[model samples]
Target: MEKLIDCHFHIWDLDANYYPWLTDNVSENVTKITGDYSSIRRNYLVEDFRKDIGDLNVVAAVHVQADADPKDSVKETQWLQSVADGSGNGMPQGIVARGALNADNAEEIIEAHCACPNMRGMRVEMHPGLNAPADYNPLKDEKWLRNFALLQKHDLVFEVRAASPEQTKDVIQLMRDHPETNFVFPHLALSIWRDEEAIAAWKRNIKIFGELPNAYIKLSGYGLFGLGWTTEMVRPYVMDVIDAMGPDQVVCGSNYPVDSMAAPYSRIWETHFQLLDDAGITGADRAKILHDNGKRVYKL
Candidate 1:
């Protein structure tokens, strides 16, 4: 079997700190959202992840931001870099740390994160519906354009995580505005609620994004879409994205821990395997989605 690179995995320890957003009202679809800190706080160290994959060659991994405190975001990257440096495991070769793109110190935050060896990019989470309060609208043009420019200045890949389809246009526009910046749309533009109209709108948006040479898409987080996501259930959506973006522009991501609520770690990988097999993607294409593309995107 070909080696894999899970480009969108996350690891968190609730005991270490707090994930304030983990509450009853977090998201109705996620069962683990209801669990207490202990239930959610299992040790998921780099070694644990390696053991979990067993024979599967996790040649490298890109650690996506896990919505912790902004300070903890930098700490998480440092911890992962230490692990990578000590053990020499190629997994976790890059980290996508968090920063308030709209914050006044955005450049400073990016510079601090980039100083770390494993820090490859930054994730500006745009979960407007879930995290945005009634008064807070992220669509304001000034902050949006300023944040996009910061990513370009630091030469960081921007990971856009919009919770709703309506926000896709804003993200795409940001990409268009900064033709030099590279952006990765995590979770297939994050339109996983199975809302037909929303999905359709996202498809149109993605088509436009696919034309942008600097854009990439991550095939991750199927579990977040709904409760039971078998390979067949998710295959059409995944294939449609692959068809739209082509294999070179897309990559696979495990979205682990968060995905553990819907299915165990093993099932998540198995589902990905089945989807790629059913799609008749060649081994080279599988390598690109699983490893090569991530290496290029994250510069791992």
Candidate 2:
């Protein structure tokens, strides 16, 4: 069994914290990216994650915000830290809590989130929509930029979630603007794998981040390609990122429960391992993607 760090799994207690995505008119407000997400709308606790992971030696894990209501943002971090303390295994050693960068309380919210011992970073989704203009993102707003600078001050990582080409362009510029801040691009920058033109743009945009010393991308959420996706079907998109970013700049994550809508938790890892094997990513370089880079990037 290989030891790994799942840099992007999520755990949520629907009764304890209100996640709009899970509690709201779930069918009507379902994520368009994953289509119908009816399968994972239940409460997914740390124990559920342990059972799903089975025998895989997940040495440590990072819990990304589970789209909890912004009012409960800091509360979510505190809740996760409590989970870590009480779960016996300290499963989630790091957390990327939600921070609304453009809000009036942005700095205050970030400060509270950082106060949590498990907090390693914060995520403010920059991808407004697939067709939204690049400038439509918060990255264009001075207030958001000002709040984002706080990450550098506190030595916290910024998890970038831009999906569109327009959004990707804006994020690239944002990375250049904040050269001192560390940015982790999760979900392969939310690739649109079925589209060739999109892949081309993704390949081109990823190179810019790959060149920057402060940027890293997480190889998770292949389930975005749809539930029936095969290893070969997803190869070009995964390889394009690895090719541009290099294995050293890439990190692995399960993006679970959300991705469980597409495939089993164990199968997700198997697919990633196969992707790495077919790419001939072996030994130290392979370990960096599967384990080491996560430890360094998440500060675990």
Candidate 3:
């Protein structure tokens, strides 16, 4: 197997930490892209993750925040850092903790997260409502933008997801406003794979995002493409992202545990390899998407 660096994955201890989505009854408000998530609701420690990967040579991996309680955001980072320090596996070499950019204590929380040795960045979800106007978008809110700039000060990555056209444009503007802060777009901008028209819009928005020097995209969360999704079914979506953002700006992640609902860890990586091969991305370029870009982007 080729070397790998999983830019996205999660290892949550349900008993140790409180996760509202996983613990509380599944909310109807949550999007059901992959239908039910009953299979991955339990704790997924480093050992469990290792067992899943088995022999795959994951040189390093990033642990994106798994929606722990807002009050425990910094606690989550410290806990993961401890896990990385003790696991000896050196998995989750980086921790992308959570911080609500609009919260009054956002900067204080960010400072606490950065204090952790494994702190790399944070994923502040900008669910900019469907087709929200520039004036109404939360991302453009004065307090939020001021707090978002804290990431730049710490030289941290901002892993974001933008679903609507207006939100994508807002992200583009945000990038322009703060070029110093690196942006990693996860889950193919959380595309609506079931709709070709939505995919077309995603393509247009992704192309615009690619033009920004600070923007990067992660190819992950195939499970979100819907249950029983084929490699062929999602190949065009993958290719379009690469076409827009080149190998250098793109990175790959398992979106594991969550994606485990769709397929095994090995199968997930195999699908990623197949998708890249289908796109004719081989040699160093292939290495870039697989692990190199991840190493550089996450400083693993």
Q: What's the CA error at residue 50 for candidate 3, in Å?
A: 0.5
Error of 1 at 76 (Å): 2.7
Can you write out model 3's per-residue Cα lDDT over 128-203, one digit (the tens) per residue? 3422343455666899888888998887999885445546767788899999888998887755444677767787
Per-residue alpha-carbon lDDT of candidate 1 for residues 144-237, written as tens digits (9 for 90 to 100): 5666687778778888765466566677777778887788887766554567787778777777877887889888887765656677777777
Per-residue lDDT tens digits for candidate 2, residues 1-300, read 778999999999998898877887864424667888877888999999999989998999999988787677888898898899997278689999887877888778888888878889988766655323445668678888888888888788988765556567777777898998889988887554437787677777878888998899888888877778788877887888888889879999999889888788899899889999988899999999999999998899
TM-score of each: 0.87, 0.93, 0.93
Global Cα lDDT for candidate 2: 0.83
Which structure is stronger by TM-score: 1 or 3? 3
Deviation (Å) of 126 in candidate 1: 1.7
- RMSD (CA, Å), candidate 2 to true, equals 2.3
